[model samples]
Target: MAEKLFGTDGIRGTVNKGAIRPDMFLRFGEALGYTLRKAGDRPVVVIGRDTRASGLILQSAIVSGLLNAGADVALVDVLPTPALGWLTVQNGAAAGLMITASHNPFHDNGVKVFGPAGYKLSGAQQDEIEAIIQDPGFDCTVPAERFGRVVDAEFDVSSYADFAVRTAGPDVSLSGLKVVIDAANGAGVSAAEPVFRSLGAEVIMLADVPDGVNINTKCGALHPEGLSEVVRANSANVGIAFDGDADRILVVDENGEVADGDQIMGAIAIDAKAQGRLAGDTVVATIMSNLGLEGALSREGIKLERTKVGDRYVVERLREGGFSIGGEQSGHVVLADHVTTGDAIIAAIAVLSIMVREGKKASEVLSVFEPVPQLLENVRYQSDDPLSAETVKARIESVSENLGDSGRVVVRKSGTEPLIRVMVEAYEREYAERAVNEIIAEILKADGQ
Candidate 1:
């Protein structure tokens, strides 16, 4: 059987489980290093991780494997995922790896590898590494003389922060902005606050304390309710909530109403187009993006091109067309003009610049479009081929037909988790909710839930 380690993004799972254990991570590192060594001589691989308690163990093992394979290792400690990608290009290294599970809890950790150009490794690159790891006879041992040096590079983290600051452009400043930053207590624990404060914003930090276990506990992008409450209570002008790795974000308005990627992209796209900065006069998003966003962009004569789910694919589509803006509804916005990957801090700063330029309120600027009623539900199953089941297919097709032109239904297996997702969109709120619930119920029944 083929090595089924990589998913939509990278290898991710609960620590101590199948593909996330130390042994596996070590092998992953060795395989990655072994592969890179073939492409060039004296390959350097930079490493970073999040605040998850398991990250240290995994990082150490991976680093060891890389060293054994004769690849130089540079450790930046804990930082955002985008920083890893950015530093890959900055250091002129062969590759970069970030040990994180993103929005998943601390017990979960994974590795995302980036190529020299600061983008996620292409499918062919990942396939080569996977093949190496799966080969039972591959050699990972190396003589001591070939052992690569390891550097504790604190300056790399500082450079990424500096990069974030410069991403806001030379003319923009947040001098009077009172920004509430919810760092998710993961990688953002070290990133978001400094950038905002340095930009002259009065920062009220929330969920910034990462005690290993508290990375995403009711904090960050996944659970923005706490951020909303705090934003409302503090009367802060805006709230920025980052995922564990800080590659994505969700902005909370002053009223504590959370604005997702759809709203954020809507506002940014409008502003970029008005400033004549939007490349190709287009924006890219995933199939999961809100229908309202498509309509809103249409009104402005900007095309809303979509790809499959995953910010990696969005970034791929963005680069292919030279589009300047692209992202997911989950708030993984990619300003291709700046960072190669999604940088929540950079996206927030860009939006803050827009706010300053327009002299508008956070709510007024963020609420760029009125969203149509949409409902999504997840159904967990023990089998990997649930989507292939006849009952599940029939129900999904039935729902899709019911929604017709006035509505739509999206049913797909999650790339990161072992769950099937059903999303219903319609003009009527009750209809959308009912359709999603019914399909979820049917799937649960089919799976014997």
Candidate 2:
């Protein structure tokens, strides 16, 4: 097992390799169960997973570990990540474990742990779990008489759909809208249709069949081109595409234009501000959010608080500042009023509700601002500190100085993967592209590539 298990989201990697192996998942579950059992007698832990073939192996291993450790388990099969967290809180479970790799391909998988309040576990909490897993003398199994039970809780998923529908409020309805949803053949396959159809929208589904190996294959929020084409072909009012775990989304407008998280966050902020529902008149976003979002929100007397690149960081800032909304450029939006984590469905419902209330087309409502030209590239590396190289530092400094005020330069290592992400935003696309290439060249040179 790898010494570390958690990443920016959770422990994720290719199936049966590294920390993603079934044995590692079992150890993680045993550790978590041990902790939960220590906290409460016969503590219940809710579990869910996306539709991946490997999920069967990982789930069974973890459930066995949890049961052996005397932790009761409730399995809500094939549910979205956000729903797992919500259910954890609703059931007062000691914790919730969601097996998914979010937007990653089906070959990869992960396990995300949610605390009692439905928030991701804290770093300290993760450390404790790791310690338990790594301890050689620690026993994970309980006496036979102390073993806990496992139950299938599939029916509880409908309650989550009901809760998501209520996020749009009691009076809102999508009476005349034709909505197309691309579920990415992931966890949202079974959840998206019912929610939208209940709201009176004419619903069409794509990528909704989960054959266990097709999730995020040229579909979902990561690839919106196919969705855009379908939206235009069907004359749909809007198109929504969700990632593997359905915790994030990307939207397609009537003009076949795709709107990313920055645009969506800006529109939601403006709407919430107007409705007096925006707490602190602030929207939290990662540094990866487009500069145009900042400028647009500023025009509306709203503040955009920037955090490090992670929805967890954004949510932390939101909770600390009592803000109502926050998210990433990747469509992982957190509407604090409804969810403890990023929930694509709730965020989509919010956008749809705005359209219904304003009686505006998706293009008109979604295209809230013109984004500044931005270029992003990711470079994988094996070095321990590629950015520490003098040449790379110099190039970063030079680019930032050149793009001061009018543009921005962000270069950082990804927390979830061994890659450096380089993003350059400027008034002109060509300039942003050139600047990003220059930095990547320096990075490559520093890595001896």
Candidate 3:
């Protein structure tokens, strides 16, 4: 049978809409509970959510379904997705659920499932759950008194903060630097401030207050203009912005310039290499990573391996190749030795620690690699037709040949949207812009309007 609900991340949509409605989420919980019970006995499932207004309602529906299927539920309120993943494995639970739309707008919501290993559910496991959800013969009912009880658990954000501080090693501390943290009014607001304060940095916070409807609304990594202003206003050493789920982070230098994932990864990689901690002298990144990053690492005799776009794919490559570091350009960094998933707070701490130890400015410390000129344009389509039209394909090929060794082009259809993303990277800004525009024009033509 073909899968219908799950995406590359999990089940997601505009809340109260197709497949993400309350009834569907309830059914999903039941299917997940049943699958876990069949694998073991009276399995425990830990659940967490971001600050989206729909989170509580969805949490209630999911908990009801899990309890009816005889699975004990631990409701961890208002925690980051990675924290839930950590708690799931730490408590030896059978699975975990996080109610979040991640970087999506507040109007959207999602349910992400993590297996016993604390990683996202694999394709086979997700398929099994979908099968159970679809089967007419599968029973989702449970008798009264047999229904599992829900327990409200206090999640200690301080524990994660302590862990992040410790990971910077004994020799590092941000004792005197002034820093600003923008929490995107999402999950990190609770922990990020304390963590920086504990490390002795002067902390200024913005967008940390979540009104349930404000999470990721013109703030956080997707919209960092406010963060830039905050940094400039305070003359802070640096600024950090976390997404709605707090699994990713982007940096802004004291000069109010945005520093993306490539810059962050390059900074960390150089430090690791110097400390002899970068395993096999290699770092794993997605294909979307700027070519400048690869060139920078090459200068230091370090290798860059490209994986697919997902952080999971990057992590899988890291493990398979025995590399210690990997991340995406979107700022989802994974230090396998530290945490199971991306922890934005932890990542920022690591970067700041480097600054402290080196006795350098945040801009100086983070500017380990220079980025090439890159441009990304998304072309929306009227229909969900395939983007491999002869005209579009020919244009891409021609652009690639024209750029030759001086640059590269990547044209891909977005996984979650009916759009084609045309990206180009070149040594010259004008060339990159022209190359991307050519491909975009062709894609627009292929859309038949």
lDDT of 2: 0.90
Model 1 CA deviation exceeding 4 Å by range: 152-155
Comparing 2 and 3 on TM-score, the stronger one: 2
Model 2: pairs clashing at backbone N, Cα or C within 3 Å: none
| Pairs in steric clash, model 3 | none
Determine which window of 10 residues in candidate 1 has minimal summed lDDT. 149-158
**Residues 1-449, candidate 1, lDDT per residue (tens digit)?**
65488888888888887766798888888898888888886799999999999889999999888998989999888999998898888888889999999988788889998998989988888888888888869996678898888965544877989989998888888999889999989898777778888899999999988899999898899999999998889888999999999999999999999999999998999998998999999999998888999999999999999899999999999989999999999999999998888889889998898888889989999977899888888888875576777888888898888878988888888887888888999999898988888888777877777
**Candidate 2: segments with Cα more than 4 A from true spot:** 152-155
What would the TM-scores of all predictions be? Answer: 0.97, 0.97, 0.95
Tens-digit lDDT track of model 2 for 1-449: 54577778878888877667888778888888888887798989898999999998999999989998999999888888889989998988889999998888889988899998999987788889888887857997799999989965544678899999988899999989999999999999868999999999999899999899999999999888999999999999999999999999899998889999998998899999998999999999999999889989999999999998888889889999999999999999999988999998999999999999999998889888898898889999977788999889999999899888989999999877788999999998888999999999999888888
Ranked by lDDT, the better of candidates 1 and 3 is 1
Q: Local error of candidate 3 at 135, Å?
A: 3.7
- Give the C-alpha lDDT of model 3: 0.85
Candidates in order have lDDT scores of 0.88, 0.90, 0.85
